[model samples]
Target chain A: MSEAVDAFNIMVYRQLKRFVRAKSRLFGSIVNPLIWMVFFGLGWSSLFKGSMAKALFGGYSYLDFLAPGVVMMTVFMGGFISGVTVLWDKEFGFLKELLVAPASRTAGMAGRAFGDALVATIQGALILAAIIPLARDINPGGIPVTLAAALLTGFAFTSLGITIALKISSMEGFHIIVNFIMMPLLFLSGAFFPIDPLPEWMKVLAYLNPLTYSVDLARISMLGSGSMNPLIDTVVLAASSLILIGSAALLFREATID
Target chain B: MDAIVAENLTKRFGELVAVDHVSFKVKQGEIFGFLGPNGAGKTTTISMLITLRKPDEGEAWVAGLSVAKKPAEIRRRIGVVFQDPSVDRELTGWENLWIHGVIYGVPKNSLRRRIRSLMEFVDLWEKKDTPVKHYSGGMVRRLEIARALIHEPEILFLDEPTLGLDPQTRAKIWDYIEDIRRREGTTIFLTTHYMDEAERLCDRVAIIDHGRIVALDTPENLIRRLGGDVVYLHSSSDRLEELASMLSETGLASDYKIIDGKLMLSVRDASKAMPEIFEAARKLGVKISEISYKRPSLGDVFLHYTGRSLRDSEGSWKETARIVVRRRR
Candidate 1:
């Protein structure tokens, strides 16, 4: 047990050092979401105000309606970027070194996932601070719960990213997958708009995507209103997280570390 | 007792066989060299022995634990330095060593002292706080050796330890390897394409070609078997076979071959046989454009066993094929 802890700590320390060294990556994780909140939210406020957005959000502004979605976006992008680090390690031969070391594969995956989740949380928090003053209707009293949701959601998506990174053979393939999977999931999750009025087919796809559940939960917790039941969304998000996290661990266990 | 042993070990990737029925044993405290051209399964075999890769057939025991069944035990008992550099470029030298020590379950107090001693030994104590990316190639290689030794395993495996380094640095690495062996009596298992490296460091060397051990013996014994002298006579024309027959008839030398328009022969004495060799060349009207004779090096031993030079054979067709297969999705 101590050995496993040591391995996890070492893995975490290594990743933290890498993150510190790569400042551009730190900026990239938060910059995307901050842009969405500031430019898009302000631009869309006059267009989306005093409609269902106001009613469902308890008279909240359009900027408030968009805040949770941007937070979830920050988590998702941060999680996806985490996988690129694993790919870098693979290309640089450090992955082989870690695999050959006297540590369990479980510990290795856990450490990497934790590091990714930590980065996601930090980026999400920073973006949230930037978005909070802009979204006047948001209740600052829910900050603690919102932060918890971001951490769990980030962890779930980070695990998913790591699982994909482990199975994919090359950086090019991973990039193709991120394009095919991440972008579409973000669109269908209703990050820019509510999912209630979408076509039946689109609704089903959104339900299937775990990101939608995360966005819905974030929306309900932060803005206090969304079309979906907040309780049901939380449950679904937690279950989806468990499934992906379990599968990631299994995939990491079976992965050939070479 | 043998520090490492393999019995008919085999590993396959899909239909391609990487390591085929390979078997060998290294007695405790011997610097055994596993010499092979790239893709002759040297790294694959070493990975299996270190419990990093699973063998498809047969079994290997490292420090008395079956590598197939008791990989964790084997991992605990062995240290590995991979061919590519493994040090974390982001971490300082001392931090890298400390992290490795901690992961390997070293006590904190002991680790502090070990890190200092190891850095000092590798001549990196002055730069211990600097990130590895700042270190020279030779310094990183030495730090890797230090990292491997931190756990103090009974057996250590170094895969191409001095590859891609200057000759001077390579010799320095060789000196460090020898010093470690003398000081600690660690069983060293290393792989190299450099004949001089094998000849200098390894107590016994196995020359592997095409996934099979072609020759296994002490370097001196392998060279002695090749008659201690190599004579290369490059002819102007492709008349090597004819010249070889004529030289045989003159009763000057034995064990000769005509390869690539060169008449390569081995003899006990080159000084005494040169006169007769020249006479035979003159009689056959063979133009000896280049005539060179030297004490039989490991290159001669490799040529004797595989009929090809080590330097030429590395990164050959087999390695190219392996890379193609490895790169395939």
Candidate 2:
């Protein structure tokens, strides 16, 4: 049992060390969400702050509503990069070394998912802290709940990312997924705008997106106003996190390296 | 007990059989060499032994544990350096070794000292903090060898360990390998196409060709089995067959054949038999324009069994002979 834990810790330590050592990635993760909150949020909040702003934004400014969305988006995008790193490991021949080790592949996969989720959650927390000054009336006590939502969302996406990386053979194919699936999911998940004002068909997609629950849960914690019940959002995000992580582990056990 | 035992192991890809029904055994603490040219099932055989690929037929036992039933146990007891460089280039050398040792369940109390000693043994102690991306090819290979030994496995499998290195560096790697076997008494199984590597490092060699073992024995024994020194005589006229028959009949050469209009002779001692050979050729009216004799090498043994040069095309001996004839014409 200790040896299994050792394997898990070794894998997690590797990812953490590599992630921290990459200075460019650290810089990018900080600057990226700022662009979304400052430029996009400030630009669009003006148009929505008129008489209809209270009704559309649940009695708050556009930046306030968009802050929670941007936090979830930060964690969401960060989780997506876990797959690229796995692909890079495969291409560079490190995956073979890991596969041949006596350690369980399931333990290694869980460690990787958790490590990536940790990094993504840190990035999400950074965005949350950065935007707290720009937006008003954020419940200080709800900060823990917002972070919890970020972590759960990151874990689910990281698992999904690894599963995709295992199934796809090439980085080019992963790029196609980024353009087609990831971007579409991000836009339709109510991260950039309110889902209630959307057409009926789009609302179904918003409801179906796992990110919608994460964004809604974050909104309830940060702003005390959300479209869905907080309990339902929390339950759905936690359950999906468990399911995705379980599937990723199963797929990882069958992963082969050439 | 034998460290490894393979029985009729086979593997196929589509319609092609990569590894045929092959069987061999390696004694404990002995260095065994699997010698073959490229695509001669060398890598495939090693893959099966290392538990990376499942065999299509037959079974293997590594360290007395079945590869089919207990691959995890086999993996725990053995270390492998793949044909391709498998080190993580992004991580520092120290980090790479540390992670590998930890994952392999090297005890935490001794892991640090083990990594340090391994790095120093491979002469990479100063560069341990540097990322592997900055390492030279030979350094990367040395680090890989050291990492494989971190857990002190019972057997070490090296697949073309010194490939693509300069002769000096290759010799250095050889010394390290020999030192490992001497100090730890670990069973070393290595595959290489270089004749000198097998001849110098292995206690026994199995020469594989076309997915089969053409010959298997000690280097000296394999060469001895080829009879003796080889003598090549090129005649000015097409009288090679007459000269071959004359030399064989007169007991000047133990065996003689005609290849490319040259009389090829296998003699016990070429220098002592040269006078007799010249006399026989003269009586047969065969003018020997050029004559050369050299002690048999592993290459000669390989050719005697496989009937083709190791460095040549992948075709069978008959096809190679036909190609040679066509080129001459």
Candidate 3:
């Protein structure tokens, strides 16, 4: 078991090392969300300056309202991007090395997910740092709480990415699904708009989206305002991510050895 | 005791039999070569023995552990350098080795020492800190060889370790491989269609064709099947048969045949036979294009056993593997 843990750590370290060395991916993840925050947020804020829009943000400026949402976006993207890398490894033959290693594939998969989650979480935290200079409404003490929420959110998507990528044989197939799935999850998660104002059917879908919970949790922690209570939101997110990550591990075991 | 053993191991992808009733054994500390034509099940066989894929039929044992029942155990005992390059190009040589050592459960205290020795062994110690992307093809292969031995596995499997390398780099890689075998006495199993590589590195070569082991023996024994001292005589002479008959009538040569537009003769002694053959050609007024007598090689052995030269299978494994995968999909 200890040996497996060691192997797990090694696998995680490999992913982290790769993520760090890439350098561009780190800066790359930040640029997209930063643009959304600066241009989209300012543009949308002016439009929302009307009475009909102020309540949607709870009187917080559009930048202040969108900052936490942007952090969650970073976490979401980082996790999935990390998960998609297994396909690269599979194509290039590194996964074979991991599979042939004495360690458990579950441990290896878990380590892979963890490395991605850690990188994603760090990226999320960097966004928070960037946001802090612009958005004064963020609670200083709630930074750790919001970061934890980002980490959990990253794990859930990272696990989902691993689970889906494990079943998908080709990297092209994975990219299609990622591109297809990423937009709906982000747009519907109440990141840019209010879930309450959405149509009943869309609201149901928004509630079903895991990113909604992640965004809600991070947004509430940072802004001290949200649709759901922090405790309940965190509990549901934690439960679902655990289940997703657990099943991801199981799927990884089946895919690797069999 | 044998370091590895396989009994009637077979794997089928639907109707295509990738490996059929394949059985072989490698004695401890011997360098065994698996030689075959394209898509002849060499990688499939290696995959089975290294515990990457389970055989659909029969059993294999590596380092005394059953591959079927104790795959993890088997995996722990063996190291493999895959046909495709497996190094992390982004990581430095030192980082790649460190990650491999950690995955293999090497202790923290000895990990640095082991990495140092392995780096030095492959003569990459000076460039240990350089990213693998910056390393040359020969350097990457050497790094992979060292990575495979990081855990001190009982067996090391190399799949076409020098596939695209130049002759000089190939020789350098072989030197490192030989150094490993000499110093560690690890049983090395490699797959190659290159006859000379097998001749130079292998104690026993197993030649497979169409998912079956056609011949298994030492290089000398395989070549001996061709019989007699070999002579290469490329003749453009129109009366080639007449010249061959004239040479044979002299009783200087025993057996001869026209292979690939070249007249190949096997004689008891070429030193005494070459002059007589040249005199006969001169008397017949035959035009000999190119003639050179040399000892038999593994290429001859492959030809004698399989009726096809190793050159015929060159650069086909990749295409074959791609087809196999496409068919599987």
By TM-score, the best candidate is: 3
- Candidate with maximal lDDT: 2
User: DockQ, per-model, please?
Assistant: 0.47, 0.38, 0.62
Question: Candidate 1 on A1-258: residue-level lDDT in tens?
Answer: 878888887777877777787799888777878888888888888677566767754467778878888998998888766855677677766777677777777887777777777778778888888887887767787777777777778778888887777777787877687789888988898778777778999989988988887787787778776677877877887887778777777886765545
Q: What would the per-residue lDDT of candidate 2 be over residues A69-174, giving only the tens digit for each residue?
A: 9999999989877745677777777888888888988888878888888889999998888999999978989999999898899889988888877777776777
Tell me how far the alpha carbon of residue A240 in candidate 2 is from the true structure, in angstroms, after superposition. Answer: 2.0
Model 3 lDDT on a 0 to 1 scale? 0.84
RMSD of each: 4.4, 6.1, 3.0
Deviation (Å) of B295 in candidate 3: 7.3
Q: All models: lDDT?
A: 0.81, 0.86, 0.84
By descending TM-score, how would the candidates be arranged?
3, 1, 2
Candidate 3 stretches with Cα past 4 Å from truth are A256-258, B228-230, B234-243, B246-252, B257-262, B267-289, B292-303, B306-323, B327-329
Please give the RMSD of candidate 1 to the true structure: 4.4
- TM-score of decoy 2: 0.86
Record all residue pairs in model 2 with backbone atoms less than 3 Å apart, i.e. clashing: none
